[model samples]
Target chain A: MKRLLLFVPSLLLAAFAFGQKAYLEDPDNFDPTQPTKILVDIKQCDCQRLLGAPEVFLWTWEPAELPASDPNNNGSWTSSNPALAMTNEGDDVWSFTFTPTDFYGVGADAVYSTGFSFLVKAKDGSGLGGGGCDEDKTENLSIKPELPEVPVLVVAGFPSNLLPQDVFTLVYDNSQEEKVSMQNLSADEVYCYASAFVDSVEYEVTPFFQVPNNAALQMQSSGDGTFTLMFIPEQFFTNVPTGSTITSMRFVVRKKVYLGTADQVDDPLLVPVGCP
Target chain B: MKITLKYFFILLMAAPLFTACVEDDTPDIGEEGSKLDGINATWRLVEVNQQDDVSFTLETRNISDFLLADGNAPQITFNSADKTYSVDAKGKLNFWGTEGSWTFDDDVAPTNITLSPTGESDILVNLTATIRPVDKFLQIEFSRDCGGTSIITYLYKYERAN
Candidate 1:
């Protein structure tokens, strides 16, 4: 009996050393006294036996004592936000990219620590299964244990502008992560951006900052009271004009609304001039 | 000693429970719900009998010589003032109004359609049709014996194009 107790400590020590980092932390270790923002990559781990697509439910909690923690775990953590969790195409892998809502020191004056753990559930409630279609029940059905540490950080500044267009593109050392796309551009707004996606499937919506045309523009109304976007191309163009400055041949000149979902065009309007 | 033996026996019995945890977690596959019912809307005749068959009368000469056309040039415009026009859900192209007495037998193969005129049967055509959203063209034929025993067929095709 004494030897068994002696072996338990060594077994625990070995387990702790080999275990993966299962908590959230600010990777940059920013000050928690100010508003801190960190982008988390909640990726799918390969530990699941079935084709498991991981969906996360995030919360802030006080860490419970080990072994005494609730087993059929009810909500112990305070919920923050919910978002659509997507998966990597080739595998059963999925990920959630999110930042905490009140990263700024909204609740306190001093640095504090709290537990943030995501309760992950399989998209299909049937947990990972054994090999083959014939098996009824084989393996012990228990939550596969994994944990991620949540690090608190101090926020440095308010957004210089609260406009929805303000965005930060994180270019990492290798730049392997997916780039988010900017969306819903309006008329007369100009933007410039250079970006590439981590995966080809996500390339369609990669976001970026807008660059406006150099020449200031104004709306010039026609006799029919329909206005056209007018720009003095001479000031903006450094190269010879290959295309007409007057948008007569292009979509901007006609101001056509192609219909589908507002995002895509199914059948374009074909009204003749002054038809409407 | 007796208690330890019982615990060992329990663990041994439970070993089978933990041996192969494979459960068929596959989701149930069901047939996709019935293909959305084909919509009934005004369709124009594209060809009276066969496409590009000029033997079909009322074929226009202005179009491509190979293309067969219609004579009446009938265009179905929704009477914007009519209360039924606003209630159409199939979009302006394929929808009908509230008070629509429309029924279609698209469930049967090679569906047949009939139009029942509202209030006045001869002057205006109100339809309950089995037309698919595809096949935007409809042909209506009327045969009459004219000029002393000569049977003349009036063939007209309406094509759907805005």
Candidate 2:
């Protein structure tokens, strides 16, 4: 019995050191807060089972206690936000990217992830799984895990903004995970923006900001990972010169960490406005 | 106090009864509704049936050719007071409604209608139409016998744009 206990700890310690879904290969390239992409190359599970693409659920929480804290394992390991779901990129490789703002709801005085964990459930939920060690760290908290592999950010929803006459609407591909798009736009009274799926994370993104154009924005969550965005165009561009037309106006999701300190999440939603 | 309570109870009991008694005695429109009530409202093209085989009794010259062009579905709004119709495409009224007059013909299934432009009297000869009114739609057939060689028929369907 004593030998088995000692052997288990050794095995767990090894898993902790080498077990990571994937790491941010280049966290310095783009805004880390945005729905950034990370090419997560998944390594073989300790279980030695032939791995397939699994539905990854990210569990982020403020460190408070150990396994003894949430003994029932109800709230701690619960699956609520599908925003962290991952996509399998064939050849035993997978991709997981999203705006942490969409998942973590922390603000200026917010607590960063004292600990974050990924629960890779089989796409079938067929009683098979892979996560942290089966040790007492259940109550332990971590800001980041030291898994062997590194993961990048993945995003969803590519929009084609084809607004006809009076009615304006956007369509996106919905056959993916926690997909988010920022392409819904409208032209009404003031320069407004309709950003969708905003998170209360510090240094995150707002719907729209003053970028030369007289722009304002509003957002409402819509069906199947979609957001309806309405925007106002610059008055000058509104009635552009006969031959001139406005195009490729971008709005991103970012949060304000401080007065001059803020960052964006994931990718930006591109739209076209102005000139008839 | 007792009287107030009794009146309050009576008012509550009578409220629903009075509400149910309210009725829309303003008369009901026909199952298909009236087409002339909105004679001046904007009408938009929804469907067209252009057949090149019919009688050439009234001069016909392919109106579908002018309509169903590249972009923007065509629409026409008639000004009852001025007796002039305005045609708009892509929100701009610069296409075809050049001071035209319209009159309703007496009928049932296929309502016979006439469209005559003031200056172009020749167009008035071929613009007379027998329209089928179906639930906010006016389906008109522009047919010509082609003087015996071949008959051409073009069906243009329009709906309320507003």
Candidate 3:
């Protein structure tokens, strides 16, 4: 009887510790200082009581230094606070979106060093029995956030990320042009051939040379070999069918009179669209 | 009796002069014709420039042809008589509404105009107007701020349609 009791608890602890996993939704563009959604999969965990629970909460203590809005409040193991509740993302997956620096009440340095340590649990923790995995809760989970690298400024999008409805601005630094034929091009000579991909269907605007409108494809000059094109994706690409979702955009800057491939500033650049 | 009669005659003559010297308190209606006359005609959008407030970067584009290609060139008519303005943007531009009331900050040498969209009196948009006496071109500039810092400025250039 004693051996069976010990084995049962050991199996429960092992299931709780190894079955749960956490990851960021948008890992490619994850920035520790920005708001990001962390998803926790508890389908494989032994937390039966939490799988169908109406509400789940996040319990974190990684940074050691807690924010003023910390839901733990030193230690509230028995009471699940509403502020710590995790959003249910269906199929036994829970999500919590927060800016690490803001949520932890710490600086970027602290977040980079400590990362995040958390676990998903039910609101009623009375069944936990003082730190023991006796109830519906995952074992301690940790995430080491990686920051994205800063670009050197060949082209940059204002606001970094964009949605279809946003007033998007694509800035081109002419000084960084590598092609010999594209160098020292005047503002009036520079134009962009742009296209928006909606539902995998490409919808291109008028070509630079064949533009029916006068200088419609020409980029605006800001002096010092810098140019910009600003427009709302949905408004600028009028041919896009109604109610279609824009997935991404592609464009290439070239001379107004395309003599050859050498007239192009660079290869076509692709920009991914993000959800609002 | 002869000396008193002479003094009273002198006083009566000076009273008329004093009354004539008094300045008229009524406002000047600009006898040379109101400044609003220059902007009263219907104007169509010709060009638009978006300038960054921080870097002073500019993006200028001729939008008149694009507007025409879309079959709707955005136009606005300013009625000086009723102090009202109407816009026919055809959903191309979002700066102005269908109709609104307008007023110049200084009626004599006005540099700025305030527009109040219909049914939205609390929301006001102030635009700097550049209108020359002989030029048919009109330029209105406005700034958009984010987090209490001016970020971008929109300059709309228009030409007299009528």
Q: Which candidate is the best by DockQ?
A: 3
Per-residue lDDT over A149-238 for candidate 1, one digit per residue giving the tens place of the 0 to 100 score:
433211111111111111111111111112112122234322122121222211211122111222222222223322233211222222
| Candidate 1 chain B, poorest ten consecutive residues by summed lDDT | B50-59
- Best of the two (2, 3) by TM-score: 3
lDDT of 3 by residue, A1-276 (tens): 999999999999878654658877777887767898988888665455566777788888876646546554334666666777899888888899988767777656566567788877776675656655676678778877675554566666664444565466777888998778888888688788888998689998985556425465688887889988877788888888999978888878877778878877666878776542
Scored by TM against the true chain B, the candidates give: 0.30, 0.51, 0.66
Candidate 3 residues B17-130, lDDT tens each? 999989989896554545678778898887765554434123233434434556566888988889999999877655566888998887777778788888874233444554
lDDT value for candidate 1?
0.28
> Lowest summed-lDDT stretch of 10 residues in model 2 chain A?
A158-167
Relative to the true structure, candidate 1 has a C-alpha RMSD (angstroms) of 28.3
Best by TM-score: 3
Deviation from truth (RMSD, Å), model 3: 20.7
lDDT for model 2, please: 0.40
Give the per-residue lDDT digits (tens) of candidate 1, residues B28-127: 7653322123233443334432111111122212121112222333333222123121122121111112232322234343232222334422222222
lDDT of each: 0.28, 0.40, 0.72
CAPRI class of candidate 2 = incorrect
Runs in model 3 deviating more than 4 A are A1-231, A237-276, B1-32, B56-72, B119-135
